[model samples]
Target: MTDSSSSPITVRYTCPHCDAVHSIDRAPDLADRSVTKHSQPGWEYATPDDDLEVRETADGIAFICGEDGPVTDLEGKQIEGCGRPFYLNFVRFEQGVELDPNPATYGGPRFDFNG
Candidate 1:
């Protein structure tokens, strides 16, 4: 069964040659857009010659190099310059709550005058 409590909020890039994996965390809703922009010039410096393949499943997305054999990211495409097939996988989720900071005393309970 899938974990409905939370959704994947990160993308992991794994290099086939070097076996190195890089993880990028983002808001769950923004993951798709973030992955798509990686191929853009200003976003990741990927050249038109660089073959980029993207696959999306119900859970997440994957980006792989279409070229045969090993590939290198010497241009710093947000990944290490590893000579191998580059794979980007997004499948892990983090569950948590974001709360605003309180300015009350450190050891005291919060109080509301309106209450």
Candidate 2:
């Protein structure tokens, strides 16, 4: 990933099916949250608005095509891209390592519910 302590970190990849170039800008601090305490190198979440759910790891990142349907530009015009799920593998040492789907879970909740 590009280094920048304050600026947004941009991740770029090519679509597998359509070969379209895509870029995602993430907060610089996102790198810090990418890894779990258990050392599992990744993070997964759905956007609060329920669009663009993605899973990212040291090995790679996977994105659901168009979130729900065709992706749109800031003006709401549809941008051309294959509406299919795709994975981008981060090649390391000439190989791509896959992460375990289930990593060690963090110990339950921080506060007691009965309070």
Candidate 3:
């Protein structure tokens, strides 16, 4: 079998406001570990943490952009992007990987409602 950890999964995201493109390489093993953290007790119902840049959701991973941008290149230059945060939804089967359809908005204003 091949080592999935050694292979870096490339995830490319396009800015919604601008046409600038951004790409990131994520380790499968690390991504899995981050996603697994979402399952901890009270994690789902917890409030959003502003300090977190990257967070895992029930469906996939979210890339929270800062005031500067999302990621930088090998030369330490920030990639050209609109700086708008986005998400990549994972379409998984059993234990293997599949396709990521498109990037979605990362976050927005939250409101509490009582029924």
**After superposition, candidate 1 runs with Cα above 4 Å error:** 1-7, 11-13, 25-55, 58-79, 88-115
TM-score of each: 0.23, 0.36, 0.35
Q: Tens-digit lDDT track for model 3 on 1-115?
A: 2243475565555434443445555445433322221223322221123222233223444544433245554454666554455444443333576432222112533555899
lDDT of 2 by residue, 19-55 (tens): 5455665444343212222222354343213322232
Model 1 TM-score?
Answer: 0.23
Q: Which residue pairs of candidate 1 clash?
A: 71-84
- Candidate 1: lDDT of 45? 30
Clash number for model 1? 1
Candidate 2 TM-score to native:
0.36
Q: Could you give candidate 1's per-residue lDDT for residues 1-115 as a string of tens digits?
A: 3234555464444444453444544335442322221222212232223322222222233334433223334443543333333423233343754222233212446777984
The candidate that achieves the highest lDDT relative to the unseen native structure: 2
Q: Which has the higher lDDT value, candidate number 2 or candidate number 3?
A: 2
Best TM-score goes to which candidate? 2
RMSD (Cα, Å) of model 1? 15.8
Better of 2 and 3 by TM-score: 2
